[model samples]
Target: MLSGRLVKWMLLLSEYTITYELAKAVKGQAVVNFLAAHPVPDNETISDDFPYEQVMMIEPLNLWQMYFDGASKISGTGARVIFITPQGDLLPYSFTLVIGVYDHTPNYTRSPEEYPSAANSGRLLKGKVAIITGGARGIGAATAKLFALNGAHVIIADILDDLGPTLADSIDGRYIHCDVGRESDVESAVNLALAWRGQLDIMFSNAGVAGPFGSITNLDMDKMKDLLDVNICGMVHGIKHAARAMIRGKRGSIICTSSSAAIMGGLASHAYSLSKEAVLGLARSTACELGVHGIRVNCISPHGVPSEMLVTAYRNFFGKADMGPEEVGRIVGETGSLLRGRSASMEDVAQAALFLASDDAGFITAHNLIVDGGFTSAFSTMSFIYQ
Candidate 1:
């Protein structure tokens, strides 16, 4: 019976193999006919998701903007350049681009630090009060501005005294100095939020560190512990006090920042992964505990967001302390996503936080909204080194 079953399986495989080849041929022919009928449009309105893209052209290189830092140019040290590919993907010149045709010189333009948004009016979280940890810059600052733009009263909470107050002032929001690693700071921030608005509508625990980025074998327990304290305990503190403040209102949204490292190993440093994974566990635990109080607890796990945190991580990883943020950004953005032509940005992650904070995600809880552009799901078959 086993032999018979094997024979049957072999027959099935033979039929499938034949069918697969036939299907491929038919699909190829169809794509050829379709493209033959269609004319290639210009840059202003060209679509990339076309069929039979086994062959590509130079239009891609034409779109990219090359930039070298002013300091590097003055130093005359070979003049390194970062390529902003397709208005989104930042790819370093050294990085391989398998465009099926290919290839760059130099063209400096506006940085991709600016992002377009879907929420224009201050209506999504209108009248809602929010505490955004790490709101001084990067994803946190972007979320704060987006939140304020969408009508939420944003409190920029961070240890960055210089930038935090400025960001809050720009948005007409308040700024609170919070280390996040300290429960007291978190509690105080929550209290301040409640004191200002009489209720806490949202708590976005977005602050995190890269944390001693190198081999797991070469690690310091003390440094690891500190990373965990900031990444895990910080999230816990936010959930705790936010829950306390939220229970009063009987409805609040709590958003925690995890990393792609938590979901996929070697995507980040050992200490960072340990910290972020703990964040997920804490997020799950707090979500279950706080759900009873009508609070939605969720995590946004971004993959290689081009922030100062990641910049430092890459600097450590590549052993290039002299590497600037632009180069770091290009390096990350290149490998960030499985979605071709699209790279996850600070604004993208911020928008996700905003969604979780708003009434839109009222029913979403105990959820991990992975902002990886399907990377963790699809990025497979690596030897899995300790990042």
Candidate 2:
């Protein structure tokens, strides 16, 4: 029995989740002039230092992409966000925004070019500082270079006094001697990182060690303990100290280096695989704990990289002390990798580290990025059946 005009009004009001009682006459809205800066009687005054206090506002969405604000009810309008003081005075979003007391996640996006033009996504870590453990060689070293190239102040933390300092110098970075296996060393690295830039934004827990070829039946408990000390315990120490440093800023990214051996069996010694697998668990658990503090934890698992670690492991396993890295790389590319003709490289792992460290991956946490060319996701090729 409703008229079309009344039905149209109902639809319009429903858009705002508002309801009105029938039998009540429509009311007019009152406009209150708000003072930008003034003291209440016997109370402290407030003011805004943030620029451009206006009717238009910008806010970041849930993790990715820019939050384009839509037209909404204005301050002192029908729709409002309000707060009551102990003295029972009313405060709206506009009032606090005007006074610079609105503490929001986007408020932390104070960086220039935070909202860049459509042509670019902006610099990934333009004002950020990063620390890379095991940064003297291999994947850690590669990532350290990439991080610096992308505008982060890089810290190369490693036990290699000679190589670490040289690499740091090459990238205009600072070198700190740090063995992730030692808690004090890791703690010192984080402290040094904070000292250099007044903030620690990224921590790459890329330090690890491998064990020689052995089955679980022939497991060397002593060697297993040693590898665990470097691989598993080391990553945990990085996470522990990194979290302490990150908690102060209320935001950070921590990346751990695991391996495809963690996903596949018979690929590595029992101890190495066990330690890498343990990293996945550690990243996920700490991610859950530190996510509330805006800190992210993730792992990068690259399969069959031709790094010296794998080369040495292969040399010991096959009793080919004379074999070179290229030969071993070719063997892995042909036999183990699904993507034929191309062996994985340390740079590939470094690129994965870059993505996880950037704001482009803001919502990514507790993730295991397998840069394996589909090695772990498939069964063996079994080409004899096709032949």
Candidate 3:
């Protein structure tokens, strides 16, 4: 008999977990204190059916003390939580939770002295409307923010309605819950975006998955198919519909999220690499055919952008221990390139997309920008270095 407030807290916590796995980082004592802070209804009794002993054994006071002590350390650091049920099955309670003190700055606070204001920076996309899939976080969120800051009305499409709206609110953009893998949902999202801004100028087909990272010899066929449906077919659907809309409007830009793995072999699992290669082909062919209609089709093959998909892949395929996401990113940055010696960040990829989206790159069509810090080139020179 969970109280309504307890249920609400659990649900919120669960939602947080879905977006990240740090919720699992909350120790037993922290859970108890959190529960105590938002106590259950007076007459309600908690269920004894689950693993109560493991939970009750936590030291509440110690946990609260640790949380406060570590508040600054964890602030703005996205941590995900994963929960397992007594039945030995994985639960869907993965979410990113930020642990930190609150800052209540006024909305009209002056821009930091270091940054330039809109008045000083020329607007590259003054009257354009852009749609970004999976725009709630990671690369998608960064792209949305970049577009809005550059004077474009952005439509943030993501399945995480909460994060999407929060991100949009921060950028003065609009959010729509869209699973881009679903055709109907995508259609609705496009319609919604057009209704808000009267026309669509850029469509970023960036949502994708690495799928379950395992050798082909032992991988699940069903999982492989699911990955293809979302990674490959999803991009295809986005291209098809985006092209149709752009043809009607007589001008547009379509950018897909291909990967550096697409241009080379052995970097990722079989399906992920294959899907990205397919995306490249799709972008090239669409660019050729859609060129007549004034729509530019391009792909950005970025390397190691600290995305959730890449984090999962590192843990799964590399058999790496749970070094924090940042640590994983640092390792990728070191190993990904010889020239820059850093993995491409979300900002790097967004900048590439921004250039392609803007009129500055108007002549750039059917182009595949390898934003991989010379990864492809470095790999080719590996034998020379050894010699």
Best by TM-score: 2
Candidate 1: tens digits of C-alpha lDDT, residues 118-184: 1111246867999999999999999998787566889989999999998898777899999999999
Model 3 lDDT tens row, 1-387: 454422122223333432122333454323311211222333655453533322211111111111221122112222222335566433212222333222321122332111111111224565688989878998998888778756688888889977999888876788888887788878877887778977889999888877766677898889999999888888877888888788988889999999988988878888899999999999999899999999999999988767887786677656876745786678876777765456778988988988899987888998899998888765644557767
Which predicted model would earn the best lDDT? 2
lDDT measured at residue 184 in model 3 versus the true structure, 0 to 100: 81
Which residue pairs show backbone clashes in model 2?
A: none
Give the whole-model CA lDDT for all candidates, comma-separated.
Answer: 0.68, 0.70, 0.68
Off by over 4 Å in 3: 1-121, 317-321, 380-387
- Output the TM-score of candidate 3: 0.66
Ordering by TM-score: 2, 3, 1
**Model 1 error, position 313 (Å):** 1.9
Q: Positional deviation of 130 in candidate 3, in angstroms? A: 0.5
- Candidate 2 per-residue lDDT over residues 1-387, each given as its tens digit: 211211011112121232132111112322232112111212222243221222232221121233312312122212211223455432222211111111122222232232232111223465689999999998888888768755678999999998999888876789999878789999999999888999999999998887645566877788878888889999999999999999999999999999898898877777888899999999999999999999999999989888898888789878999877898879988887888877888888888998999988999999999999888897666756866
Candidate 2 — number of clashing residue pairs? 0
- Arranged by lDDT, best first: 2, 3, 1
In model 1, residue pairs whose N, Cα or C atoms come closer than 3 Å (at least 3 residues apart or on different chains), thus clashing, are 122-150, 122-151
